[model samples]
Target: METIHLTYPETPDVVPSVMVLGFFDGVHTGHQAVIRHAQEQAERLNVPVTVVTFDPHPKQVLSNKPDAVRYITPLSRKLKRIESLGVERCLVLTFTKELAGLSPQQFVDDYLIGAGAVHVTAGFDYSYGKFGEGTMETMPFHARGRFTTSVVNEQTEGGEKVSSTRIRKLLGAGEVDAAATLLGSPYVICGEVIHGDARGRTIGYPTANVVMDASYVMPRLGVYATRVRLRDGRTFHAMTNVGRRPTFYDTGDVSIESHLFDFSEDLYGQLIEIEWVRFIRNERAFDGLDSLIAQLKQDETTARSILS
Candidate 1:
């Protein structure tokens, strides 16, 4: 797909394209439906399928507690997922105070019209412009003679709407299977391996420490069965932990540590993606190093069995 970063007054020259717009955080089933509709429309119209999304989610800019809000998929992962959907192009707009101040009509004129969109597709609940004044009712008026608008209804799974918020809740509660159903894939957190205290190595199960970015939502603190994909794209079944080592000392820093089963190699500084498969148990303080090591061994066995 031809992905581009767009800004007001610096829009691309492509025109008469079918465009899909939204945060598309996790690119969940609902997001997929909208993208599919846009792609189908583009195919029928013989135009390019373009996706419009924002970077640093608007919520981060508008919320008072922006730092506290977590994301279902970081920008990199979101782009990968969207590209996998076969869209011809993706445009990421940088959300800023000045851009956020644009009125609904101005947003349409500046972005939709400027991007040369002949038609636009988005979720039914999608909104835009300063203070979110843009709505389904207002889209057509804003488009006027410039473009057409289509709204895809909310996608439901088991009688409930599939959404990034709901998926995050499921993941935070350790409901990996449910989150997967909503996400259309396993919930993954990827980051570069960083230096750690080397405590896991002393226990015979060396672990790769992943330093998660603040944008990504973290799963419940506990041990889980996971699949680790390395930078080389090779995936390995593994056991993962998200917590502080209470048995050793109370540092209070939440760490995501993964032990690749039966695999050992230098991994520091390499990007690793961890896919959660199942929840094993909640994190707890052990009596001593020996007890913790024993529990880790048990967790490894459980993880292997679950992955198998």
Candidate 2:
């Protein structure tokens, strides 16, 4: 799929296409429904399906506190997920202070009309404009004859709404199964493998330390059963730990370390994706190196059995 990182100057050249607009974090089931609706509309109109999303999530840009900057899928993963939905093109609007200041009418006039959107789709609760002044109530008026709008209702599972925030909370609590049901797939973290202290290597289980992007939401601190995909597209069963090495010292910095079973190769600087399947055990401090090694052996056995 084509990706366009849009600023004010780069307007879409396409004259008439069905467009879906949202942050689309996680590209969860609800976001998929909106995209699917847009795709069907595109099919009927004989036009390409375009997904319009924002970068550096609006909350992160607007918030004052550091902890407010959490995201379900980073930009790269977000693009990949959108592509997987069969979108013909993705327009990533760089969310700037000026863009955020656009009024409800100005946004439609500048983005929708300027970009040549024949039809637009969004979720039921979607809002836009400065301080979220725009709503479904006001969008159609702004569109007028220039475009048609479709608002998809929220997707629900187990009588609850499927949302990025809910999914993040679930994953943070080590509820992988629950999160998967809402996400329509396993929660995945894609990152580049970086150097570590070689703690796993000394124990005869050298690991790949996955350094995730800052925007990606990390799962709970625990040992998990996961599937690792290498840059060359090979998949392997793995056990991943997300925590600080409390036993060794109390630095308290969290890390994601993965031991790919039956695999031994230098993965430093390699890009990899890890798909969390299940949570096995919470992170804890062991007495010493011997105790930690013993626990790791037990963890390997449990992880292998679970994956098997």
Candidate 3:
């Protein structure tokens, strides 16, 4: 697949494309349906299936929120997933203030027409232009005889719409097993292994302190069964904890620590990925070190049962 980070005003040279348009965060099931529909259109039109997407999330750019915005799949991961879906080309637009100011007609004229889009596919609720006045219904009106449009009606899983928001909620609620159903795979957390206070080691369950993407949605603060994959392609079942160390009488900063089963190697500074499997239990402060160790042993047993 070819990736073109649109450098604004100038459109790339291209063949007539069957374009799939959306933010497509997580590329969750509904987004897949839209792209898949575009793929079908591309086959019929004998054109490449191209994706028109945006980065940094429009919400982060356009609105103020109480908390930091999070992504289900960051841009790099999103593009890879798009490529895996058999898309031939992807134009990732930077959601700058200038781009956000484009009128519905201008977006249709510049991005759609400029990209040589002969046919376009998007979700029924997709909107464009300044303040999102351009909607799927209005998209054809903006096409102005230049292209055809296809609006994929809501795609559902278990009778509910499959969406990035739904996935985020699932992860936030620690419902990873259900989230995977909508995502078609386990959610991954990529990070660097960093040094900790070596608290787990002293308790005989040394863990890798993973510094993950702060902009990505994290599962609820708890212990979960996960698989840790190393850069060297090694993978192991693991018990991961996401919480502050209250028992150690420490600060309240959240942390991600994973104890790999039967694994011991210097991992500081190593990049790794964690695939969340299932939520185990809520994190809590134990009365003493011995109690903490006892609970960790139980957690490992429970995690192994789920992971194995």
Candidate 4:
């Protein structure tokens, strides 16, 4: 898949294609449905499918407060997921104050019709233009007969809507198994292995400290059953802890430490992806090292059972 980055007032020469539009943060199940629908349209029209998404999130740029909006999948991971869906092109529009100020007609004219969009596909609730005044209901009118539009209605799982917000809430609440059900896959976070105090080694369970980008949404502060994949494609079953290590200190920075089962090779400075599978238990402070070691043993047993 080809990735094209664009800023407002700038355009790219392109071919007539079916445009799939959204700020697909997680590329979760509902987003998948929209992209798949666009894929079907592209197949019928014999045109390439161009996925149009925004970066840094519109909320981060538009919100008045200095709120950091966490993401389920960062830009790079999002593109990978979109490519896995067979998209031919990905157009990343850099969101800015100028682009956010465009009116409904101007946005369509500049971004859609003017860019060779023969057809557009988006979720039912998709919105555009200044203050989001343009929605799927108004997309056809904004098209001005230059292009057709298709709206994929709300996709649901277990009688509830499958959405990124809901998935984030699940991860926040440490319900990864439930989140995975809605996401159609495990929730994953990418990070680099960093040096730690080597405290786990003293306890016979050495761990790799995975430092991640602050933009990535973190699962609840607890241990979980996870699968770690290295950049070289090697994977292993692991038990990961997301906590502040209260057992060792009264207060400390929150950390992601994973003890890969049967792993012996060094991983420092290497990048890895951790796929959260199941929530084990809440993080807590143990009174003594012996107690913590016993619990670690128990956690390993439970995590192994779940991962297996």
Candidate 5:
């Protein structure tokens, strides 16, 4: 899919499309429904579906605590997910306070009607303009007879609305299995294999120390049944731990280390993706090295049962 970046006051000519609008952070199931509905409309109208999204998250610029704005899928991952759903093009608007201050009519005219949107599709709760004063209901009023709108209703899973907030809450609580049901896939973290203290090797269970971007919404600090995909597309069942090594240090920075089962090869400086499968146990300090090793052996057994 083609991606174009834009800022306010710069309107570029483009072909008419069935425009899908949202800041699709995770591209969760609900977001998928909206985009799929747009695809249907595009099929009927014989036009391509163009997704218009914002960058730096509006909350990053508008909220009092910008650093707290973590994401389920960061910009790069979100784009890949959107493209996997068959979106033809993407327009990423560089969000700023100036862009956020645009009046409802101005936003629609410049981003929608003026950008060659023949029809627009968004979730029911979608809104625009300064302080989000424009709702999908008000989209028609702003369309000015140049375009149409479709609002996909709330999508529910387990009797609750599927939302990014709910997913983040699940991840925060280490309910990755439950979150996967709502997300339609496993929660993933892409990171590099970095050097650690090389302590796991001493315990006969060498691990790859992964360091991901700070913007990712990390699963709760604990041991989890996980799958790790190497850069060469090799996947391995892993017993992953996300925590500070409490047994080694009284307190330290959080770390992600995964021991790939039956794998013994050098992986320093390589990139890998960790897919959370299920929660195993909370992180706890063991009495000694022998006790920690025993618990790790048990964790591996349980992870094998789950991933097998």
Candidate 6:
């Protein structure tokens, strides 16, 4: 897939394409449905399916609590997910105050008309333009014969709409397995294994400490059964904890530490991804190292059963 990053006032010059537009945070099942529908339309039109995504999140620039934003799939992962859906081209427009101030027509003209979009597909609720005033109902009026529009109705699971917000709620509550059902894949934490205080080694568990990006959504603070995939193309059953180590000392910074079962080689500075399988227990302080070790042993057994 070909990906391009562009700002307002600049659009690609190519054959008119079928475009799907959204922030696509998780690229969850609902998002996939929209893209698939676009692909179908693209095939019928004999045009490639293209995607238009926003960066820095519109909320990041528009929200009062911009700092509170976290993402299920960061830009890098989002691109991978989008490409996996067979989108032939991706146009990423950076969100800025100037862009946010664009009137609905200005946005449509600059992004859609300028990009040579012959057909567009998006979710029923997708909106754009200043204050997000653009909607599927309004898109046709804005297109003015320049393009046709398609709307993918809301996709539901368990009688509720599948959305990135709902997925984030599941992760926040440590319902990762539930989140995966909606996401069509496991909820993953991507980061690099970094140096730690070496405390787990002293306790004999010897965990790998992952250094994750600050903008990624985190699962609830607890021990979890996980599967670890190494950058070198290896995977292992693992267990993880996400919390401030109250038993040791509280700096208030959350730690992501995982112990890969049957692993014994050095891993400092290596990159890995952890897929949350199930929550095990809340992070709690134990009496001392002995109690911590015993609890970890139990966690390992439970994790093994789940990963098995």
The C-alpha TM-scores of every prediction are 0.96, 0.95, 0.96, 0.98, 0.98, 0.98
Give lDDT tens digits, candidate 5, residues 264-303: 9999999899999999999999999999999999999999
For model 2, give the 10-residue run with minimal summed lDDT.
7-16
Q: Which model scores highest in lDDT?
A: 5
After superposition, the stretches of candidate 2 with alpha carbons farther than 4 Å from their true spots are none
TM-score of 1: 0.96
Tens digit per residue, CA lDDT, model 4, 1-308 = 99999998897676799998999988999999999999899999999999989987988898885367889998999999999988999989999999999998898898888889999989999999999999999999999998999999999998999999999999999999999888778999998999999989988999999999547888999999999998899999999999999988899888999999999999999999999999999999999999999999999999999988
**Once superposed on the true structure, which residue ranges of model 6 sit more than 4 Å away at CA?**
none
Which lDDT tens digits does candidate 1 get at residues 210-271?
99754688899999999999989899999999998788767788889999987989999998
Model 6 agreement with the true structure over 105-208: per-residue lDDT tens digits: 98888888888899988999999888889999999999989999989999999999999999999999999999999999998878988889998887788999
Comparing candidate 4 with candidate 5, which one achieves the higher lDDT?
5
TM-score of 5: 0.98
Candidate 3 lDDT over 203-251, as tens digits, reads 7999999998547898999999999999999999999999987887567
Stretches of candidate 5 off by over 4 Å are none
Q: Rate the local accuracy (lDDT) of all candidates.
A: 0.88, 0.88, 0.89, 0.92, 0.93, 0.91
The count of residue-pair clashes in candidate 5 stands at 0
lDDT score of model 3?
0.89
Better of 2 and 4 by TM-score: 4
lDDT of 6 at 307: 90
Give the Å shift of residue 91 in candidate 1: 1.4
By lDDT, rank the candidates, best first.
5, 4, 6, 3, 1, 2
